[model samples]
Target: MSADNEIVELKSHNSNFILNIFTDDYKKAIDNIKQKFERGSLLKDISVINSINAKDLNIIDIQRIKDFLKTELNIDYKEKKIIKKNTKEPKKEILKENIPKVVKADILEDDNYKTKIIKSPLRSGASVSYDGNILVIGDVNAGAELIASGSIIVLGVLRGFANAGAKGDKKAMVIANKIVATQLRIAEFIAIPPKDDKKSYSGVQMALIKEKGIEIQQVN
Candidate 1:
């Protein structure tokens, strides 16, 4: 412990700390952390350890925590794990939304890939980056982002930013039920939604690199 009430050093060399939040006074805890950081007594890379009492925290609370850590403390927001005292297995809580599903498939003898599925609305200011393909079953609200090395499939509306083929795979594409995003990137090409606000379009659309430019066309 660094004399801070809620922060305790996990090790000397590591800057990470076990942020112990015992009470539901989340605002108080954040203020304490901010004060400690301003005084140069606290550092980044925090593993928020909360008591079972704090388990009832909703998505708003979780987002607030993340935002405070980033804007106030300048933390990169590494990892957040909760360990309820006396629990057999430490519950893996997914702060804003539920945990994503990972699926592995063997498409060919040398082709094995993974897919991550998100089943909740991706809120503004939230970002989801995956190494493999990404499937979102909910809306990608404005100010949110999704970046994937492989193809990105949004079963719901994609109103935010999306970057596919992040690793230079030009064949990768972004598919969405409805796309009204301000920006979309595929491989090295970037594009914005039509400025004319043309309302004529099909139910589904796909974005990909066409002739070295990002193109969005109705999906047949």
Candidate 2:
């Protein structure tokens, strides 16, 4: 198979992290998974992983990979059923006729496994936690807390405790229009602004993990 055909695609939907395996070869699938792990491209905090296109694999092969993933990476594995279209039906032809089309409204729903948006400000004593990114439309007042497995973005000032990359993703960042947070954290690293520090920053600011530490920088 070509290199592109051997690649594995990972996607998240409704709290399920799905791995789409293109090739049915067991060895190639294992190698591809290992490569992704080594490159730190996989999410380690997810409890379950759903595999697509794995129906052709035998029971033994499936069990082997399941054990490897659960034992080595602490991630559960499941094979999803493939939905196939009916191939025995004949094609139908449509006559050239004018028909009125029905228009429907498209309802947008929030996917809890992806980013979550908060429309109101976080008052003191308020706490929020999510498995994915978080977008806050208002200020995060002091004594409030925000924790996310992914990144966190604040449209207003962030003055409370905010922890991004709570699942240990070092690449995640925390961004805000103005940040004077009591404490900021990315992955396992934490940075607390001095109590006496009263410096103001201009424009949007971002805090990310750099050299095993959290660094705050102004975003242009």
List model 2 lDDT by residue over 69-177, tens digit each. 7677777654343456654543332323221111001001112226677889999999888776777878899999888867887878899999876554566778887
Q: Highest lDDT: give the candidate number.
A: 2
> Model 1: per-residue lDDT, tens digit, 1-220?
2355453223332434444444455686577667766665444444332211234343234445555665665653333233345524322323343222211121111132356778888989988887767778788998998887677878778889887765446677787767888688775467897542646555567787788588887854
Worst 10 residues of 1 by lDDT: 101-110
Poorly placed runs, candidate 1 (over 4 Å)? 1-112, 195-202
Model 2: how far residue 122 lies from native, Å: 0.6
lDDT agreement with native, every candidate:
0.60, 0.67
Question: How do the predictions measure up, each by TM-score?
Answer: 0.48, 0.48
- Kindly report which residue pairs in candidate 2 clash with one another: none
Residue 160, model 1: lDDT of 91
lDDT of 1: 0.60
